[model samples]
Target chain A: MTPGPTPGPLPGPTPGLRIRGLVKSFGGRRVLDEVDLVVERGEVVSLLGPNGAGKTTLVSVVAGLLRPDAGSVSVLGTDVVRAPRAARGRIGLAAQDVAVYPTHTVEENLRFFGALAGLRRGELRTSVDTLLETLDLTPLRRRRARELSGGQQRRLHVGCALVHRPRLILLDEPTAGADPQTRRGLLRQVRALADDGGTVLYTTHYLQEVEELDARVVVLGDGRVREDAGVDQLIARYTRSELVLRFSGEAPELPWPGARVAGDTVFLPTDRPGVDLVKAVELTGQDRERLRAVELSRAGLEAAYLELLGAGRDE
Target chain B: MNRALTVARHDLVWLRRDPAPVITMLLTPALLMFFIKPLYVGALDRLGYRGVNGAELAVPGMTVMFSFFMAGLVTESVFREHGLNTWARLRVSPLRDTELMTGKVAPCLVLVMAQSCVLFLLGRVVMDLRVRGSLLALLAVMAALSACVVAFSFLLCAVARTRRQAFAYERVTTLVWVILGGTLVPTELMADWVGSLAGFTPVYWASHGYREVILDGEGVAGVLPHVGVLCGFTVLFVALAVWRFNGGADKQHWD
Candidate 1:
């Protein structure tokens, strides 16, 4: 085979991934439109979106599996559109679907993908072995993928992408349908990949995963990047904790401002649950006997994401 | 090239893990040749070949007919990638579309060739079937026929929306070619119109090439015309396959 173009030294430390005015359409429906994002090296960015929000389409375009209708995506220093082969060489993508060959053993799947990634014999062997251990698939290495449980297969699917130790890893909902053990292992591996200077772009609807990774979150809604910031920042900006007082019977109204009652409960949105809880108990007065329980619902990434998407939809 | 080889090797491993379909293809043809030899012997006698055993006819006929069935291996392999959702992963790899197609089809070609040659070898050893002509000529015909079958399989894959559609086309086409091309009954025994139409099929060219080498004692130079015709069919099939195939198109693995 003839050698391909050799990459020269970069002018500076290039962003792990850079996208500008990216657009994609399917059957006249715009799936992605003017989406812009940048992720630096050693960073883990969680791509959160609802169904049909074009998260998968964006990932496909970045992985070079789908041609963009317009705009540009560059991995490290290679343009994904013009030099797809060179760009693909630097990216490892594990799509949302489990793509492992069922008839092949766990080890064989890893070896085959690692070989295709241009790893030499020794390096390939080492990488496969390390992945088998990291994904906790060592014990099941010789088992055919068809015989393994769904979680085991899911782990193997992610392992195939990491077997080559790529500089940029694109994992789309890697933990979807995974068991708790499998999810924990994958989250640890993903975090470790980023901590070791690998850039990771993860997509999932599970906001807790984003919080667990402590990743910078990018919320995609209606074919655009609606929110891009740290998880804490998003929660502070878009979410608010709620204080609730449940009643066993017809309850007295709370004096708390902006409190709303529904069914047998009163919900008071709060930034300070401690002071609000005290105010709620005092306001109940003679009807405090009807108060069955007082509960504080802490604000989290899930709430923030829901609020952000809801507001975007409202717009 | 290395990437294509990697894909080819992986395919070979899949075959190794599940050998039932291949074993059936090989054994069924060999068994049928034995049972059908006496019928061919009588036909050969009536044609004025006084002492010719039926192996001369039964061997090549069975070989040509079953090689068409071997096209299933190609369709099955390609469609299985879709079923497993691995097609997207493969496309995302560094391998180009040309290399991926080459890697996927190369093994099917080798398997078809091996299946045809093995059936002929069984005839020579067990039935005293002699190749009176150049062995090189026999091999050339087998190579050409195998290439034609593999190319035809790719065309089926490109045109069929589902695996069931591809298999249905394969079975129907193989049966039509085998009957018209004189695999079961000699073309001369059929109606005059059937004999004329037989020449239109690739199977007819393959059967003619094998007969010239094994029965007519033809050398490589004597069989070049038949080989050239089979190669022509191969080129036509490849051209159609290339035109219709869309690597990015969504194809169903099963109905």
Candidate 2:
């Protein structure tokens, strides 16, 4: 595979959001516990976890909508708990639900939220127009928010959050319940945001999004960070290797160490390739001419996520 | 501050879209004043009470009752947004608590004013309730009543957990105020002790103040004590509402 370009440095620390030792609970149930994360300007960090993994709680606390029992959250150098208004102004939150006003048209909703974010008349107009075009929502600009489809409403929610150009963005399942096409479109825009020097903290159950963005993945289980590492490293460490061997004759009964059979192919897991290849040919009683094909591959992120989550644990 | 207004503007849009509720709120007072008033007057006549016509007495009472309904509508709308988690979205924004409080107060005040105007016009044009006072006195009474309604609504919004609860509380409280304060039926029709006790209710003061201005041609001085009492209620309700608002703690859950 060709090597990708190295990423540029993060934006200045002035607008970065940092959290440390965050903890929270509700009705005697611990939701988030001692969580820590940092989203530097211009970087995208995907918080990957299953449902009920406390991802939302963490984001809420960082957004200053919730106060943690014990922790410190600082946004653009201001403590969220101490200076919530200033900290909140620097962050944009696209809620999990489609939280747009149903009574207003798309443009009106955007204009209202934009104005709330401190944009004036001329700037608000330009910003709303630009967001509409970028999200391909201009066609539905005059439509009341309640009249839009679920995906359209979700897109409008994002547009509302982006209207004022907040430095840090917290997206909670931004593409949840969306069709494949709509999900792709939203992901494209989110990636573009990161490319344009914006910091994004994305939480979702879809592992593919983590892979698509090549973002650092933080896996949470039972309100704790299970792993935090690069996607490639994660796949290498958590996934099992698989090998496919095609033979001309019936499948061999030979002890082909650590191998499984599928149709006429023998799937093997072997680190010693040359030794395994020789053994496979001899065990199959095939000459060099009878060898059909051989392939080696590692598992994807989905497999890694399953493995990390201890799939089929009862077994 | 601008952000709060933005929220309020969006709220206004939502309110306009919900035409059914507005229609019901607008019609409630008219029905009470026009249809039920004659029945009340006939009952008083049969009882041999030498007093003013029941319909005329009910006109001012219905006006204050309309103010109560207006308060409940606005408060319920805001509380519904909170229960649906939309308030969480707003709370996380740059909007401060004061801005949000102001935004909430503005629309309810506007709605109360509108309701008062509609009732006043109906009383004047349709019912021919004689206007003895200057228009300025009537205006002052309306303003005071509107302030009380807005403040009471804010108090309800701060405490209500669900939309259903808010609506129930609003309805029950308004009904109790009307029945006890002689808004629905004249206090003179009740026992003498009950009539005296009704004077302490906020609704009683509001209706009494309006009667002084519209029926007696009294200036501000004539209704100063009632105005003062209503103002006290407003201050107390507003302070409690602000104190009870969640300190940005409702948005912590991911699920």
Candidate 3:
């Protein structure tokens, strides 16, 4: 196989991926509606959405696996639907489900995909060997794909996608069902790939993963993008307040503003917890010695996601 | 072409690892030729057919029988990859559909040719069957038969939605071809109408053409009709297969 011309630094103003008014429907239900997003080179964009929000559909369309009913998708400034082969050559997708052949060994799967990516025989062999080692699959290189554990298989699937060193990698729930160690390891690789100037588009239900990567999060609801911002910006925009307070003798009843109590605990969604605490002590006539532990907390992306979904339901 | 050949090489490696199909491809023709010749001889003697012996008829029939087995094996193997979404992935690559289709057909043709050669050699060495016609005519017949099988196998792959369905369809088709095309018994023993009906089938035409070349001392022109029919079947089946192949690259169901 001959290597393609060294993709000369993705010319022009196009980011790694650019989508405009992308729409798709299944049966009568609209899965993606006017979805627009972009991921610049070396940036990690996390697509966050609840179930049935069309994350997978969007990814599949961009990967050239499915055709969208409306809108246009461009990867590296090339129209994907119009010229699938040229568009797909620069993009790699690691599907949520394991896609490797069960009877083929890990090395075989990597080499096969590497060749598909237009790697020469020498380059393919070297790349496959390097990936096997990097992904910690060297020990199981000879084992058939089906024999590996789920996490191992997941790692191998990602390795296959990376063998070609594509410019943009799309991962649809790549780390789902993986243990903490495996998940972290995969994340590290993903982050490193981004750091190496490769764009990444990932989707997952794991809120913490979005937080950990600090990626630009696009919250999807009802087939539309509800929010797109940095993780901290999203949290700051949606989270209103923080509160920290303590009570004595099985948690004293404090008439705190904007507070709700259950059993001995009082929950307050407020911005000025220190003011609320002083007021609560005066209102409840509780001495300072009776106070227990008090802590302040701010809302996270999880809270924003729930709020977004709740708002979508009401609309 | 390189990408297409790469896919073929990958499949060949897997086939090599699992030797059962290779063994079946080689052994089935030999075993059928060994047992059917004596039975055919007894029946032909009873019918007062004095000019030709059983081994002569059995040799050509075995060649036709091998085509059926090769077709079924190729269908099952290729459809297994299709069911697994491997073909869909390859389709999205730079590899053209024609390349992928050619890669699949090439392997089946090679396997069928090898089987035909083994059957011919066994017939010559063990049964003293004479090759009276030009070797080119014999090769042309074998090539036509293999092409017919490959076309049908690809058609089967197109219609088969799952590996299990492909396997079942292949088995049924192979058995039907073997039985109806007179692989086990001489077509002469059947009713005249039955023999005429068998003429319409590719396997029968292939077997009859081979018999004409190897047994009847006829030139290629004498078996032109048989060759023509087999070629027609090949074209018709390949066209249908290509039609079914269009728009099949969808999101594969991951299991």
* C-alpha DockQ of every model: 0.70, 0.65, 0.47
Off by over 4 Å in 3: A1-12, A249-257, A270-287, B42-53, B82-88, B183-186, B247-255
Q: Could you give the C-alpha RMSD of every candidate to the true structure, in order shown?
A: 4.7, 3.9, 4.2
lDDT of 2 by residue, B7-77 (tens): 67777777778867777877888877887666656755754644546655667778888788887666666
In candidate 2 chain A, where is summed lDDT lowest over 10 consecutive residues? A1-10
State which docking tier applies to candidate 3: acceptable
Which prediction has more favorable DockQ, 1 or 2? 1
lDDT of 2 by residue, A1-315 (tens): 012343632857564777788788988888887887777776778898878889988888888887888889887678999998887777889989888877789998888778777889899899888889888899999999889998898899988878888878889999999878778877877777777777788998888888887777888777878888888888877775766677677545456666787666788766565667666666665444655887776578988888888842333
State the DockQ, from 0 to 1, for candidate 2.
0.65
The docking category that best describes candidate 1 is medium
Per-residue lDDT value at A65 in model 3: 76
10 residues in a row with least lDDT, candidate 3 chain A = A1-10
lDDT per residue for candidate 3 within A23-119, as digits (tens), equals 9999989999999988888778999888888998898888887889999999878899898878877887887776677888998998887886789
Q: Quote the chain B TM-score of every prediction.
A: 0.98, 0.88, 0.89
- TM-score attained by model 1: 0.92
Residue A276 C-alpha lDDT in model 2 = 70
| Candidate 1 docking DockQ | 0.70
What order do candidates take by DockQ, descending?
1, 2, 3
Best by lDDT: 1
